[model samples]
Target: MSKKSFTLSKIATLCAVALSTSAFAEQAKDKDIERVSVYGQHHKNYITEQADSASKLGITIKETPQSISVVSRALMDDFSLDDINAVLESTPGVTVEQIETDRTYFKARGFDITNFQVDGLGIPQDGGDVHGTLDTSIYDRIEIVRGANGIMTGAGTPAATVNMVLKKPTYTTQASASASVGSWNKNRLEVDVSGALTDNHAMRAVVTKQRSDSYLDRYATDLTLGYIAYEGQLTDSTKVSVNYIRQSKDADSPLWGALPLFYDDGTATDFDVSTSTAADWSYWNNDNEHIFVELEQSLGTSWFIRARYAHMTNEQDSELFYVYGTPSAETGLGLTGYASEYDYKDQQNLYDLYATGDFSLFGQTHNLVFGVSSADMNYQDSSLYDYTTGNGFPAMPPLEDFEGNAPIPTLEDAYNGSKVEADQKSAYASARFKITEPLAILAGGRYTEWDSEGLSYGNSKVNSSEEFIPYIGAVYDFAENYTVYASYTETFAPQSEQDQTGMALDPITGESKELGIKAQLLDGQLFATFAIFDALQDGIALPDTALSTPDNTVYYAAEGINSDGYELELSGRLTDDLSASFSYSHVDIEAGDDANEGKLVRDYTPEDQVKVALNYQVPVIEGLSFGANYRWQAKTSRVQSNGTIPTVTTQGAYGLLDLVATYQVTERISATFNVNNVTDEKYLHSLYWAQGYYGAPRHYAFSINWQL
Candidate 1:
């Protein structure tokens, strides 16, 4: 069937499901009351005994007026999520491009998302050119807040923010262990244990180990993670907690090159198909270690305070090979062959301290937060060449016969090196006020200072920059079960002196204005939200000169603008036999110059995207359940060698189907089977230029869990 026909058919099916309720209602009535209360509420209520963690902390999710998605621990376990990409791939408005087995780039709302947090404390989003992959075993939940978040996260783009809540010590004792095996010789083991050591002391620990022989030839990976935490009640109204986490991974191969593009006339080029350009490759590995401490104190009637401190370090060392072509002595034109080798090393460290408090003024509530942070990051790169007959090139002959003999060059003849260092400091605060029983308002702001130094090829440069951002939002409860909200927010990106001339360029900032309605249906068992938004970024800085020069690279500057169409959503069964959640987003983006000249934006985004997932438990089988997810995205642009070519787009809107079943063989033991990409669609999860990597094919995994 045609793409349009398939899309329409899928839409029809979804509409039908939304309109029909006879089967859903009937099945829901048969479930036990215990399960009903767990899934019935559309919006969480403060009076509930089992309130959500965020709600218990007095955080309002529905009234935030921002696009956010929360992935609960229950959902993670159900899906057997092993990596950050796996968990985020099913979320709306988020896309990921994996450069290698362990490295990935994330985008949201048509822009790169470079803000991340652990337990509400900010962390480096781009860990550097080296891939920064975190093990998912230690997280309790993940939250994604979209749009300009500088008010809460300091300095960053308006794209989106990701905050990971770590596992904490609990008052109750519990332990669980799981082991799994899958296609491509994949195997994994995870264990979690938590309990109270004394009346006022609690502790928890998590450990994971995984190994995989990838679907691609010569690709393999091994990973390990360990986490531990302790919590203690210092006084009747004060609590303190500390945590430590470490992760490491080893890979046999890293992606260094991409698929060849077409020739000048658009005809495709066929490079070697068998002779591998990657030779004797391996990574000494990368490691991440973190330590954090938090203190919470509650003052009588209407005041509370929270203080937190954290330290983190990342280290990496690796060797890589590149491919190039050799020229024939007769024709002068070269034949394609292997290239050179490079050795790289890097280390980064970050420190953060923050405090927040909640108090009542007159008869209303207010929240205030502030923080300071610093980073010391470093990078080093070196290169070497080969002089042997075929030292640099692959040891094996080319896939096809070649008629040329080319001498390899010496390492000392061609070499380059560089070093970079950066430091940052920031402060921020926010407040929420309940103007009336049915109306609330929120406002906040932040300021950040940054400095960077670089030394490359014996030349050094230094730069510094600073910025401030602000935001405001309000919500009005129209009825017992409905509310309306609107918000405006601004974000800024700093300019570096080394990169930006001393011209005092204004910070690139934007405003997001939105209006939306929310409903609480099914006796509070289900919550639904819909919103419309118009977001605009003004005074965007652009390159000044279009031409390149020998001595100075021509840098230009201009004010650019972008406007977006936005939507937000949330849904689930509060008291039904089956529960589910879904989200969708549509954005219309455009760019304009200071003179109002309009141009189509390219290479960084797609105009439309959708993500959906459904999970249901069988009424007859106590431990049996099923779940599936589907994602679709419209094509975007890419930069090519010949100016800008719109030919290379992502794998045009693909669907992934998954199936899972779990059975309890004993009180302490259970087994699960998961089948991913069941249809085996050959598509790309991400695309860069004309070279696209294929998504994982059909795979099957089975896991066993034991509780003690």
Candidate 2:
């Protein structure tokens, strides 16, 4: 037989096998059945389809009018993702900027996203730093709802909202354990157990421990997490559940300093400083705990109610090291070495109580949700020691500097000082009207009051004024697979006084308006969305002009406006031998206002970003599978401290490819290997203030798991 003929025959056989396997998988999915209990109703139903329950609860991507995406547990397990950042990498319309090892910022729809929830409960945005550092082991699934979530989460940005759903216990007893070892001496272990304690009671528990000596020398991390849950059927018409989670981490990584942009000749890139700085040393320790309870009951055939209460506390402590030096005489500071230390502690306590009910009005179903919540945040910061050293500096010196031994003036000697204390309170309500089977409208608002006080180095006392913010939105479904939405949302940030006059200023507020279209297809297996938004702040608070020192240390007394363009997507599938998912986003973000004469723009956000991944099982090998991912982003500019001419701090569009393969030896044993950045691409994951933080170099990992 000719070679071409042989190849054709082989291809035909492979296609036939693929078709047969797909048909069998579809048949199995159609045959499998499970009993489902409907919340807010006393009805028992059989779920013969994989996505039936999600559809019935109006939780499917197609049913939601707003742009929405779901990342299931099956996908997470297949990718071996361990943290929120890794999980978000596979979600469309989301982009994460790692400020440091412990701090990260994320943006959606060309705007900073500050709205987040756990099981539909609101989580205040203190900043974008801590949100990305959260662990993903505690969540069974993640839901991304784009555009303004004010109607559901109250006060927040119109960018987007992320909700994490925790795993619950089932009637069958099950347990699984996983252990892995990776590059840079990284190691991780996790265990999950769930079962029924009694015929009517269920319990679930999870524990995760991780330790790693990161790619950067002297940088290390250790983390421990635990979660426990209990659920019970109080009666045929009622059900209750409680959950608790605790997480803690210890990390040591410097807040690396930025490099200079020009030489003495005022030409860019004339001076080259060390890309790696060892003089800076820092550490972060944080602990978070949350307790929540939920209850659902059916009052009658047409009435149902759901009540929920949750309390959460988060505490964090960290120290940063600032370095001053020069690599060349023309551009550098011309100093051998100089260092300063800053320390801070932040604590937040939150309590939430809410109830929702469904009732029939005028032959139409009305969903009403009303609730009150309060949050208290305390922040304390102090400058421990500030000293300047020259030439040969000791390695890893303690923060405290002795008076006589210190070459430069100490913090106490200079009499230079620091500041402290800020707090806030808020309350809100929202409702949704099912105007018709194919249409729904939602509206809501929130009120926030805040106060702050602090003292500067020159014996100056500063205070801030209070403010109130409101938000509104609407969602219209044209069909099961398409939706159109629009919204107006607002957010606020406190501003400091100009001088020591003890005078206060009104808070800087932002207002955003958005319109978008969403689509879900393949029986809720694929999702896509497109949105256009414009946001403006009438009186944005920026740094004061007069008090500009060399380092640009000024108060927030200026004004500005910001506008953006955005697009997003989320898609995936579950199959017997192959599973895959992909996400891509593009955003154009720009800022303008009277503060900096509408000329200076921020440094971090990029215009175009893309992420894609695929996992395929070996057809000939029963237990082996392979997976790969690619990520890319376009160039973006960085702004100087003076908010003047922008610097060409481009990262250059680049992609990182990863590969992973897993083999199962038995039903209870499996081994896996993963290689990140397989192409050894030289790129920077983030760049700030003209300084670059390199992406993780090519690395490999191996893992073994056992289940019983």
Task: Give the TM-score of each candidate.
Answer: 0.82, 0.78
Candidate 1 lDDT tens digits, 1-708? 232332323543443353243232233233221211333342212111122121112455665656667776666776776777877776667777664555677766655567877887764453312264676789877777767676666656666787778988988999999999999999999999999999999999999999988665566678899999999999998989999999888766544554433434333344432222333453446777888888876544333446667777666665544434332323323324444455556555555444434445566545444444556666676655554645455433342342223334344536777777766666555666778888888777666666667765544435556666677888788899888888777766554312234343455566666678877777766667776766655564454444544544433345555656666555676444556566677877666644223233434355676766566667797866676666667675454443453333334566777777777778899898888888987665455334434567889999999998
Off by over 4 Å in 1: 1-57, 124-132, 261-277, 280-284, 323-355, 370-390, 393-418, 456-461, 497-507, 536-547, 561-563, 593-604, 637-639, 642-650
What tens digits encode model 2's per-residue C-alpha lDDT throughout 180-266? 999999999989999998888999999999998866645678999999999999897798999999999877754444334433333
Q: Against the hidden true structure, what lDDT does model 1 obtain?
A: 0.61
Model 2 local distance difference test score: 0.59
Best prediction by lDDT:
1
> In model 1, what is the error at residue 287, expressed in angstroms?
1.5
Which 10-residue span in candidate 2 carries the lowest summed lDDT?
40-49
Regions of model 2 farther than 4 Å from truth: 1-65, 120-123, 152-155, 233-242, 256-275, 279-282, 293-320, 329-343, 386-425, 451-480, 496-503, 547-559, 574-579, 593-603, 639-647
- The alpha-carbon lDDT assigned to residue 19 of candidate 1 equals 24
